[model samples]
Target chain A: MIRIENLSKSFTLHNQSGVVIPVMAGAHLAVQPGECVALTGQSGSGKSTLMRMIYGNYLAAGGSIMVGDVDVAKASPREIIRLRRETLGYVSQFLRVVPRVPTRTVVAEPLLALGIPSDQAHARAEHLLEQLNIPQRLWSLSPTTFSGGEQQRVNIARGFAHDYPALLLDEPTASLDAKNREVVLSLIEAAKARGAAIVGIFHDEAARDRVCDRTVDVTGFTPQRAA
Target chain B: MTQDQPLLSVRDLAKMYGGRIGCTDVSFDLWPGEVLGIVGESGSGKSTLLGCLSGQLAADRGQILYRGRDTRQMSEPERRLLSRTEWAFVHQNPRDGLRMGVSAGGNVGERLMAVGARHYGDIRETATDWLGRVEISAERIDDRPRQFSGGMQQRLQIARNLVTSPKLVFMDEPTGGLDVSVQARLLDLLRGLVRDMGLSVIIVTHDLAVARLLADRLMVMKDGHVIEHGLTDQVLDDPQAAYTQLLVSSVLQV
Candidate 1:
């Protein structure tokens, strides 16, 4: 389970006169095991910032984020990376799979980052990809050659390959066609069935309705004043 | 429809690079207010054909006539002027069509500022009006494209292209990256805009539903050839070519 309270983050923007303007503010969210939550908001609504905070990708400035016994808000850099590698799986809106790396290798990279043996990690990756319906012939090729829909599938496969109990997905279905959308969401459902806690940001209401166990509308959150 | 003085016309438009044909012998006409849809798969050369027609890519052999004048013979300045003033292109990724770091108003009003709109107040008003027409809120005019949702960014891209009132517009998978509900709303907005403005458009897509909703006529392409061309309903409901039939049949379930 994950809990967030009074979380706040801000970024400085330079004006024409070189004045810095701060944006972002206090936000709150929580996710529990086997529960899928949808984060919905307009661009710049701080949804991504909040997700990154949950992963300790950004240090929360104002409040506490508790993931089991770890306080993500106060965690050191090394501790955060270890927590991310061992306990969380994160996917971005933009699929940024490294080019020239084999799809299977990329899927297993997270395991490798955790110092898992190559042979064992790869075997696990192969099984996951097969279950996700990725063709065997394409497993050794870099994702660059794959189509948009295909690349997304590979990305999803990589995120869930390690079986990290908590998953965070940002706009995973944004670029897929209808058929691929169904496949990707089905994969998520399977992950849920296997007991992964998932939080995904979605611009598509229909996708949220279909896959999300709960929905949080962030449109009503008031923009906090800059300090 | 073909006309003696069509706004744009292409004949035998084929593009081949290193012996790989992009699109071969493709011909089409854009009257002042017509909407033509091009549908095909990834390797079917739909985007390549649009690139060739727009002069973004060179054709192996063809005639591109604008107002009865051959664009193939036009000077670089002339082509540039035509693109900036009379022709507009909409890319699938709005970021591709826009300068991301600039203000949304700047992105929409850049074409006008390029040719000669020096008055800042006038440009702002025009940009706001176009945004309003496209259903973007007034306050978002100052936000950068990066600060918009995928759907809002696409709408801003449309506003940017249409602000110039170009005689012809080319859209490549405008709704390709959006959500299903967003796609439906955008399709409705585009259909209404086209009818109300009497704009001429050429939309490239792989979705039959998109073709059905946004186009008056449809053309199916595959492996560098226009395999089928006819009224939208006819081509989709009852196709002539085996390729078009396969493409249409792929969309239906069971």
Candidate 2:
């Protein structure tokens, strides 16, 4: 369901006299439906860069990132948004929710964006929160003020609330306790069973081994050592 | 109309004032039930872009297609009718959009009347319902907007515009000039209403926070040019252009 070809990326340092730095070159990958692929690389390697390119956060130097029928690299802003809303989902390491929005609403937002009824969406959010061990009392509060671990768990809940056809997960099980990590790993397994194609960055080797069908090392994609 | 077709399509739209550019080469599509945000510093042509889209200002170049037909080709009365029915414009200053001399009920009732609702009782009843929706009390129906607080006036203006259930709405700083708490409340109400009503909105704001909260897609303008455009979270989180990066940094410069 997700495929990328001839992908390359470079960063232009405009403040430093417009110096363009080539990062990744000639990268390619594909993930079929019901498969989970892990992106693995050393620090500063193009692991996150490739992931960002797939998510369309970084404009590609040249390539096609096909998530379903839409080429994320070439899709217009609106098309990318539509693809994100209905086809693909991403869970970044950091939680970036609007301040003061209740955690329930934040978690339920994706389903709501799809025109799902509020009661149904909220129930699904609550179920995910409960599965991840978040306290019921905190459901009405904003996730911003939660602890780092709590915030990460909330982020995971939001990402998993919708059954997106394709998903990009960044360190989803990072910094979690053993029990919560198992919960997340099983969530990944369940997603795969339900036919989702997932690409993720996993630092936890055990979690990576347990959930990912294969690991694509990003070191080969880098053209030069990142400075 | 097909469900996937964009409700509004803007192509190479440009506007100029004698020797100066208002907005130039602006283009984007707004899908049904989508929210697009234009953000920039003052005089960056965000407001000019908004005015041209809402039919308040004529563009010097390009087409604004509302559901496949170019709106610029429409006659005056036809465009007026469209504005009164399918389109609504919310000004930065509520006073500019409101009928200050009229009662709150009359202000909202006027929009329904414009759409051919002639029965006085039904108009007043719908007007009262909309006032309640915007959190204005029914008893205040007869009070002129001149007496309402800034926040209340803005809410009443919203009721007036939305009472017609316009499919597409253009908002220029809908929360400008309100207190922080009041702005939050207004945004809350707006968010709920937009979702419930499936509104297609084009909002211009200098407040990145507001844009983040309400916008699905974002276009960053600088010196009358669109420097960057992307999903709201993507643009705000990892802005690529130099101008957008500077703007994002300043927002986080607490």
TM-score of chain A of 1: 0.86
The sequence of per-residue lDDT tens digits that candidate 2 reaches over residues B1-254 is 87689899999999999889999999898898889999999999999999999889999999999999999999999999999999999888999999999999999999999999999999999999999999999999999999999999999999999999999999999998899779977887888889999899999999999998899889999888899988887788767898887798777543
Q: Where is model 1 chain A poorest over a 10-residue stretch in terms of lDDT? A: A12-21
**Per-residue lDDT tens digits of candidate 1, residues B31-92?**
76678899999989999988987888878898999878888888989998998888889999
The value of fnat for model 2 is: 0.32
How accurately is candidate 2 docked according to DockQ? 0.39
TM-score of chain B of each: 0.95, 0.98
Clashes of each: 0, 0
Candidate 1 interface RMSD, angstroms, 1 decimal: 26.9
Per-residue lDDT, model 2, residue B245, is 74
